[model samples]
Target: MKQKSIYLIRHGETDYNRQGIVQGSGVDSDLNAMGQAQAQAFYQAYQHIPFAKVYTSKLRRTMQSVQFFIDAGIAHESYEGLNEISWGVREGKMPNSFDNEYYRTLIENWAAGHTDYPTDQGESPEQVANRQKPVIDLILSRPDENPILVCMHGRAIRILLSWLMNEKLATMDLYEHSNLCLYKLIYSYETKEFTIEVSNDSTHLLALVMHQ
Candidate 1:
């Protein structure tokens, strides 16, 4: 049985991340300086591996994170399905306070697997999975023997991982991913199953983080 491999990576940190903002699909911020360096490190770390395909979200942050691969001559594609869940009414606004009751309630609900509840016009967890599943399916169906790199947002990544693993969305809380963190998954074409080989790896970024 031939196994297919995929590398899922969250995009580098954005200015909003530094500001403690909750950005969603509606936000299209670019990578901050540290984020750019992290992306570079990711590229350097994986330069020796020959990737068959590279996919990225339409958002600037994700696009920027994978730009290093492009600069190194890797061909890649972009997809809107890879975009983060739309934050809707809360797109650009910072919460009134860290403990804002309403905002905290929404996050808590999302983390608890309330997939259908939308927070301030944002797409629910189910909605995010709906969009991400198709892209993942497409990747799994590819016939290529080489690995594929998927560049996307944190929320979308979590949703996709949940769907792929047949786990509840709330399980995402157990995984703490940082900027440009990489996860490797192996897909079995015969059984349509995927096994996670690694999660949230940032050996490439350690030096960069220390330099900051």
Candidate 2:
């Protein structure tokens, strides 16, 4: 059976990431210096692939990360469904002692298989999955010949992949993702099944890091 392929890329580091601040969906922050370099590295690495379409989250970081691909003449589109989970009340807070305790507790719960538990003003894993699934189904329904490149946030990508694999949401906590990491996915047309061909592949970034 012929398979449809999708390349999922996590957006590069952002100013919030560098500053250890909570960004969530409250603000659309752009990429930091390291992020720009990472995006460029990704572009150079995947330039040979003939992607049929490219998708990016509405956030500035994800959009900026994929801009290189568009500049290289690749067809692309932006989707708000690809945006990160909202952190609500904690959006612009710095990771200080006051917030650190709350943040640690939230992260621990999430990592400990609590998909339904979310921060006081944040999105639950289930809620995020609910919002993202429809967008993914739309992508899946496209013609098999169309290879897609998806640029999105870390949490959203994790939720989408876990849903595709029918894995528990908590399993996402086990996977470590780096900025600008790329994952390859293959979907079986006949059986309607999907498999991950690559997860968090950053050899391209590593090589660039070494060169620097």
Candidate 3:
């Protein structure tokens, strides 16, 4: 089996993120000032990794979070598959409003093992895993030794992490996920399996240790 590394990161904070608004795949926003700083700090710390390619969700935030790499001429691609879990009508709404009561309930249900629950027009967690898993399989099928970087959203990263680690998709968000936090997975070709090397890591932020 070929040994490979995959680095995953959530997009930087957007204005909506700071406002505690919902930003599913439908809401595309750029990184705020603090988000930009976090991105820079992440790059300064891990720029030495020699990534083979960079992949990001189609949303602006994911791309913005890793803009430094793109600016430095790293090979990159945007995939719709990496987009966040769709929240239906709550895409641009606040988290706790009456309209999003169902949304909140759905997520709580998801956290509590009801993976099939979703609000009006929203996507089930299963749908997200179906979309993200294929991309992961394709990347791991390659016989190269180069590492890869994937910049995506919080919920999507959680789903991807669960899928990659062969864990129950129902508990994808059991771990903490901060904006621009990193997760690392190592793939063993001989065993044709992936292992978690790190999860929800923000050590690169140094002084921003308290940052969410």
Model 3: how far is 11 from its true place, Å? 0.7
Relative to the true structure, how large is the alpha-carbon lDDT of every model? Answer: 0.83, 0.84, 0.83
Q: Write the per-residue lDDT of candidate 3 for residues 113-206, one digit (tens) a residue.
A: 8777765687888888888877777777765737989898888877777766677877786767999899887888888788888989988887
Tens digits of lDDT, candidate 1, 74-184: 788888889988878877777686538876787789787787888677788888888887877777767674687889888788778887888888776666687899899
| Candidate 2 vs. true structure, TM-score | 0.92
User: Where is model 3 more than 4 Å wrong at Cα?
Assistant: 97-101, 209-212
The lDDT leader among the candidates is 2
CA displacement after TM-score superposition, residue 80 of candidate 1 (Å): 1.2
C-alpha displacement of 156 in model 3, angstroms? 0.8
Per-prediction TM-score: 0.94, 0.92, 0.92
- Give candidate 1 regions above 4 Å deviation: none
Candidate 2: deviation at residue 150, Å? 0.4
Which residue pairs in candidate 1 collide? none
Count clashing residue pairs in model 3: 3
Candidate 1: Cα lDDT at 24 = 89
